[model samples]
Target chain A: MRALVVEDYHPLRAAIAQALRGEGFAVDESGDGEEGAWFARGTPFDIIILDLGLPKLDGLEVLRQMRARGDQAHVLIVTARDRVEDRCAGLDAGADDYLVKPFAVPELLSRVRALLRRAYARKDPVLRIADLAIDTATHRVQRGSQDIELSQREYTLLEFLALRAGELVTREDIRSHLYDFRSESGSNVIDVYIGYLRKKIERDDLPRLLTTRRGHGYILGPA
Target chain B: MRSLRWRIALAGGALAALMVLAGGAGLAFYLQHTGEQRLRVLAASQLQALAHGLEFEHGGIELHSLPESGLGWALYKHDGSLLAGSAWPGMAPPGSKLAAPAVTRITTPEGQAGMLASGWFQPDEDDRTGGGEISASLVFSTADIDREQTGLLLSCLAVSVLTASLAALLLAAVLRHMLRPHTDLAEKIAALEPQCRGQRISTATLPAELVPVAERINGLCDRLEQSYQLAATFHAAAAHELRNPLAGLRATIEVAAGPGGDPASALATCHQIVRRMEARVANLLLAARLDAGQVEVRRDEVDVNDLLVQAWEAQATRAADRGLEALWDLQGSGIASADPEAVRMLLANLIDNAISHADRPGAVRLQATTTDSWVTVEITNPSSLDGERAARLVERGRRGASTSSDARHAGLGMGVCCGLAELLKGRFSVSADGRELRAVLTLPEAAEFTYW
Candidate 1:
């Protein structure tokens, strides 16, 4: 999963970014609203963490502009404005969730995960395809009675594909969701990660759950 | 008369009653006087007719015809002796001689009140008395006049009492009608809720006389609302200032507690965050104390040069981190008689502001000079703030355009510095010139002060 943090405070922004990155998310950060808006407009982020008090442009205006331009990212407002009216205004202005400052990082991460789930139209924290189970809350995967261990990058890619189980996911989609702006965009990186995921999740005794369409994309369910 | 309406009504009613009493008395007196004069004229006419009717055909004179039944007449000689017609007992006294026509109040034989007229008159020519002059007296009963005057007085009294009562009621009713708007205004003011925004006494339904009063109350309400809004904004700003650092502390702790997290760096950042929060809270408390005039001042000889060096060194790390260079020029003895702590706080805030807001890769300049009785310190730095923003930089809770760039600053440094300068009996001012922002503090020299 990918996310964008638009907070003005440096320490807080860095901390939130680091926490999200640790939770297997491709996190991008901006310290001001203008740059945050620019990043939101240019990229397809699964979740956008926004602060109300930002320099150059207000967070509400950025959200308004983003919604006006038809960017459908789930926005989670993280601000120091704890007033009821502030919360209501933030939610009314295209925000998926409102979290006041001084909040617990675990709660923020939970809300971010919930928003990502809502974006994929999934209500349960765990995604299932036949016998393959992916627990989004813990980033753990299991097939039948066997537990599987995967790297962070491998887990993030698998979770993205599992969220859209039985649907075609393009390589461009994988690249956008798995890699942030700072990461190098190399060709065949998606195939290389997919091979690693297949080696771990696929076994000779179980039916293959991952399949690739010729010259098209990859899907996470039976063809 | 504690109530205005009652006061006005009672005053008006009392005045009306007084006027009615005075008019009633005057009318009663005039009516009595006129009634007595009419009785006197009746008596004189009756006595003259009796004299004209007198005849001397026999030894005694007789009236030509009997006088009216209510009239009592008597003919008397010049010697004051009753001759023929009868009169009231006091009409012709034996020793009293009738020399001229006179009217007097007398009692009739029946004890009825009467008016008597007595005078000497010529008898008929063929029937003359001893000297051709006869004195006659006529008594006219005044019982009717007394009854009419009594009735008139009673009627006047009754009318006066009735009119006074009616006047009182009318006056009270009119006054109440006139003061209805005032009553409504009082009720409206009493019902006003202080927390309700835009609540005001409506002047549209008020009388012209009360419009100004209502307008003044509305104006006061407007001012109170503005004060409330200002307080709310200040509170929100203070909360934001505190909560940002708290969030940073919490996030840092959470991250440092995670797998492979570096606890040492996290502790350092946490300490920094706490320190920043402490400074912000201290600034807030100082601002409050300064506003309430609760801060104490002590006169001490303080070296401005040393204070500047300490302030600069304290912020040297921040300055270096921001890639800002510092330069200083000290001239003369930079000594001032002021509160040492106050001076230190002021200098630290100014220098910190200079470093925080100074353009990166630029220089911050500090200059100190001493005149005959004053010590002046000036801090100048390259800034992108416009003149308008620089002018308002010292205002409480006002931040710069790049508010997001500096999280450690709560926008209270310059304001606290301004307050401390005032507490120390110094002048502080900020100005913007092109791309440079400057702050100057002037304090009294040590020689110009006496021990406090």
Candidate 2:
């Protein structure tokens, strides 16, 4: 994936560049906001990483110019200001995402991967890991050669866990993801749904991919 | 004369009043004495005429050209013969030979009268005692004395009233002129506004008494203008520096931790970043607010025990993580009027300092006490310094420096604490016990203090 990095600080900018490169992204860089805006307006990229404070022109103006010129590449705003108004203004100005500074490298790579994957709009989107395929486009689950008939909610629960494979997914995360909300169910509904997904998608002999991290939260990863 | 500017007017007027009264009284007295002398001379001349013109024939004496308006004369001979002439009512005629010259009061058939008499008797300047013949004269002239006294009284009253009025007018004009500079200064001060901070109070061409006051006012305005600009610059720079990083971090977390990503490590890292971001934002906001003079603290009487417990809730987790024991000994209850937000900020800073710097397992103590006049809260902790060195830690806080090894924790130095203390209408100081550092906060007792 290709991304544009707009920042003035040389060390921080280089760090972001190296992190993006490790994540397999072709990155174009600009130190000044005016040049960055021009480059973004003329080219097509997978995502645009724009800093708020830039020399010669402000970062908001750059975003406005890019949006005005009809460029819809995913624009993520980067700023040191963790204020509510700044975030709201950036998003309202056509920024697809807003991030505060000094972020971990893995987190940045993950967000870039998510944005790229979303832009693709997978037809017949399915989440698969270790021989289990939960087809979102078809609302069906298949374990090896077995065609599992499952309810819509059980399929959603299995799909949410299979999306992030090999990491602990909290019950809160699973409940929220399956229902598109924080759970109103008696807090053990996630355990019941996981039981259903276990019965439908995994063999009684297979190792589990969904796990729990006590007291902290949850994870969806390899056993 | 009652006006302060009319010093001379009042003094001169009083002196003038004294002089006028004394002069009027002296003139009245002199007129009375001179009038008596003139009346005596007239009486003597009348007696001489009476002695020369009298016709002592048989048993009567006849006198002419008498000027007879309440004037009467009588003659008495040494031979016990009485002679009277002229008819004027309310008059007295003397009997017997006069022993000496006199002015005496006499009683007549009508009323009391003044008679000026000359004891001169003559008989053709030859036989003055013929047939015991004697001549005596008495005159009545008391009405003139009454008129002269009335005129003197009227003149004195007129002079006194005129002097007082003149004194009042003179006093008013001089007082207004002397106070002119102060009035002008007041008008200039009223015209000044915050936008006119660059404008200076000019003392040139003003009274010498007003120059120092004007200079001080100008110096104050200059400092205010500089400080206002400094605050503006700080806010602008802090905002500009923090905007991009925070935006980037928020976007990264929302996408990375939401769905379809490694959740365990990502959430942990995101939480840490959020905590730091929250601290930095809070500190930056506070500094900007202090510089701008924007926050109006709502001062109210807060129970120190209640406030200490509330502050501890926010810092308890951090304290536990650092292995420091946090405790409060709130004794006798006392009230202190303070801004709750500022007090919270101050106590958090103090407790945080203790948690970061004190040795592992070291104890932090917050104690509250009140005398009759003042309520004090003392927060003490274990430290490496003693006595004077501990005292210097407080001075360093007031002066915007760190005196501890854990100074970098939370971005709040002692200077911020000092600033917060001032905002709360209180004082922040430090003391020590041997090797332990103790910070003290003393405020006026809320029950006794009055707010403007």
Candidate 3:
């Protein structure tokens, strides 16, 4: 999955970005609200971590402008304003979650994971398709009780495809979700990762769960 | 008297009592005068009847019959001889003659108080034995009139007392009713909560006399609310400044505890974050102390040049990291009569601010000079702060536009520097020319150092 962090404080921003990247998320960072807004308008991020206090523009105005432009990314506000009124205002401004500063990294990661689940309209942490099971929380996959191991990039792509099981996911969708703005991968990187995922998850003993339509996209359900 | 309502009521009651006493006194005097006049008229009529009843025969006067009126009467010859009267001997002095009709109050020899009327009359031809005038005197006792006057006075006193008492009570009740708005205002003011901002006394229903009082109180409330809002903003800004580094420190430690995390780098970052927090807290504490007048200052001789150099050396690493150079122009005598610790603290904050905000690859200029027992130090740097932001540089918790990116500077340094300068009996000022910012600090020089 891909995410964006918008915070003015350097050390805090670096820490948050580092923690998210370590969790296998392709993360993009901005130092101010103006640049953050610009990035939000230009990219299709799955989640946006925002701070309230910013220069050149306030974070709430940026969120308002983003929502006005119909961006559907889930926003999690992290700020030092701990007042009840401040929290209510942040939540009322279309933020998906709120977290005060000095928060534990584990809790932030858990909240991000939950927001991602909500984004995909799934209540369970594990996605099931026929006999195949993918534990999203553990980033592990199995087919008919046979454990499968995949690389980080391969896992991310498979997770994206599995989230939309039985539905066609285009290559552009995979590229936006699997890579950030800093990623220099060519157009075929998505196809390369998909091939790697299929080699590990597909077997001769099981029915083919990965299928591709001609000149269209890929699906991760029964063919 | 402390209660305004009671004061007004008491004054009103006293005035009413005074007026009632004066009116009652006048009424009693008038009743006594009329009563005396009535008695005089009755005595005069009885004396005339006695004069007419006299029948003079053989040059002698005789009363045919004494009228049954409750009066004493006597008839005397014109020569002051004995007359036919019942109480003449005790009514007047013996041999007292009447020349004309007259009335007078008298106390008879018998100690009877009476009004006496006396007159001389000429006898008619048919009833005269000789051509001579007859004198008659009548005396009416004033016992009943005196009794009636006393009773009237008693009744007047009773009525005056009753009226005065009633008037006092009525006046009190009326004043209380009229002053009800003042009471309501007191209750309303007492009910105001200090925490409730924008709560004001309504003057719309108040009396015209009390409108100004209510308006003044409302104005005070407005000022208090503004002060409360400013304090809240300052607290929030301080929290933001402190909590951001804490969060960073916590995240760094967490990351360091994870697998493949480097401990040395995380520890360095945590130390840096803690030092930054410590600096901010120190600045805040100094500011609070300065505001409360709790900071102690000494007049020890301080070496301005040494303190400045030390301050620069302390922040040299930071300046070098930011790729900035320091230009020194220390031309002063290098001495001032100020507290050494305060001067060091002030120089440290100024240099820190200069290093943090100065443009990279630019030089920060530090200059010092002395003029007649005063040492002045100026720090100038290439800054991006506009005129507006620089003007407010000394205000507590006010940060420059670009400071949001840096968590190490909490905008308290400048304010604390200004406060410390003042505590050391110095002046501090800042000015911006849109391209650069300059801070000037002037302090008193040592008395003996002036000759050096």
Candidate 4:
């Protein structure tokens, strides 16, 4: 899948593109709102991320055109304004979701997935990789033919890893997904959880679907 | 009617009433005393003239000169005999005539007097002329007395009444003039408005006694102007700083969710980041609004319980989506005095903060109580003592700190919540349990207390 990033600031835009590439999405970039609007209208995009404050054509206008042209592509609006009126205005301007800037990479990837899945009409809401399966509807997990009974917290951890499957999820990405958890959560908690999941799934009989990426988070996919 | 003006007017009116009464009473007493003294002097001199003209001849006492017109007299002898000369005309005895004359006092119709002439009789038994039994004695007519006394009293009372009325009018005019400056100053003060921050109380030509007071008012205005300027600057800077993070977050989401993307993976990541950024932004803006005191509270009759249910609905989805649990113990239809929008925002911020900070798989408790005059809502979540300190850090985050500094606790969430509470004119308190955090907000009951 491909995505478009519209931002005026160079450093911040580059950082965003780097984060998206790391998440395994092909990223197309625009420095201003006018060019961003042209790219959005001329090219078919799977998702369009917009900045509210942009040079030339404003980000809100770009969003308006995308919706006006019957482009049903998933649109996420990102802005520095967290005011109630600002949020209302963006949603009114045809944005599917709103994001504030300076966010962790994992958060960006998660919202991207929720929007894309609804757009493409994925039948199995639960994600499957080899012998491991994650049920999004019931918050359930299964390894091979056996049902794996995990704690609510352990389920949340596994869901984050399963969302990306083969991609290298970082420690920061895992931390960001654990919204209810704190930055002070122990550094090895992820490694320990991965160990617990391997034992519970009886990895010997099932194919090894969960693998650690050294300093990064565990990946749930065949290498 | 309850203000200082009414109070001062009442006091002035009472003073005027007292002055009118005292002046009227004093004037009456002075006129009566002077009138009595003047009447007595006139009557006594008349008797003196009658006594000086007495003459005895041929066995009878008679007046040598013509009797005074409009005067009448009667004489009594020691033998209880009565005599009257032709001058005695049709005189009657006065009510205040002396019963026995000597150097005696009397208050006749003629007015108060001291009679000086003796009352005696000379009989014809000495055989001077034909035995006619003639007798003589001094007499002063009391008729002249009445006319002269009445005239004196009427004149004196007329003068006294006129003088007293004039005095009262003068007194009132002076008092009202003395009070004019104070009343004028009071009116100016009452008319002052908050928007008139630059106004200086002009007592430049006022009475010397009010100069210091006017100077103090001017000094206060100066302070108010400085504070207002600072607050405006803070608001502008805060808005500018907040937009940076917002722009960056949207840019990342647009690219990841576009064409060459793993639509599933990129969209999921974008949702998480947006939710987190929204939380931070909401809190910061709330603080700025609170600091500026710009929250417009459109007050309405609101059910606290209903407001809570709505707030919980917004938050419950997010918490469930994150694998968290929520519980509530709400009072049924608790009525409160509040702005509905303000109350909802208050509830939303607190609940969202709790859902984000509460322990995973742990329960968040929301409880509400309503009293006759106030309603209170409290939210309890998993927390520790360290969390309490961290919460304090968040509360103070937006005030006078370097935003560029990488401080973990100095994000916008708690600061905005604190600001919102102030703007709503409600009370907010945060405390930590052994392993939980609690936030409580108290608002007035609209049925009992009004916003103003």
Best by TM-score: 1
Model 2, residue B343: C-alpha shift (Å): 28
The per-model DockQ list reads: 0.48, 0.06, 0.37, 0.08
lDDT of 4 by residue, B1-452 (tens): 45554555456655655565566556556665565555445444554455455554666666655335323444444333454453232222232334332332333445533232333333434433344433233334434554665565566556656665665566556656776777777777777777557677798667888788778877877877867755653553455444454444455555555545454554555565566557556655656556556667676777778778788787687778656777889874477777787677677777777765553457888899887677889988774435445446344443333221211223344555566556556677777755777888887767643333
Q: Rate the local accuracy (lDDT) of all candidates.
A: 0.82, 0.62, 0.80, 0.61
> Compared with the true structure, what per-residue lDDT tens digits does model 2 show for residues B145-179?
54765676677667655765565666557657777
Give the better candidate number (1 or 2) by TM-score.
1
Which residues of candidate 4, in runs, are more than 4 Å off? A120-124, A127-223, B1-30, B45-230, B242-452
What is the CAPRI rating of model 1's predicted complex?
Answer: acceptable
**Clashes per model (N, Cα, C within 3 A):** 0, 43, 2, 50
iRMSD in angstroms, per model = 3.2, 11.1, 3.6, 9.7
Candidate 3 matches the true fold with a TM-score of 0.76
TM-score, model 1, chain B versus true chain B: 0.74
- RMSD from true fold, candidate 1: 4.8
- Docking quality level of the chain pair in candidate 2: incorrect
List the candidate 3 regions with Cα displacement exceeding 4 Å: A34-38, A64-70, A83-94, A144-153, A167-176, A180-196, A212-217, B37-52, B55-62, B65-68, B71-230, B258-263, B312-334, B351-384, B399-410, B425-452
Please identify model 1 stretches exceeding 4 Å from their true place: A88-93, A170-172, A181-193, A212-217, B66-71, B74-137, B143-226, B254-264, B289-300, B318-332, B355-384, B399-410, B419-452
Better candidate number, 1 or 2, judged by DockQ: 1
Give residue A61's lDDT in candidate 1 (0 to 100): 85
Docking quality class, candidate 4: incorrect
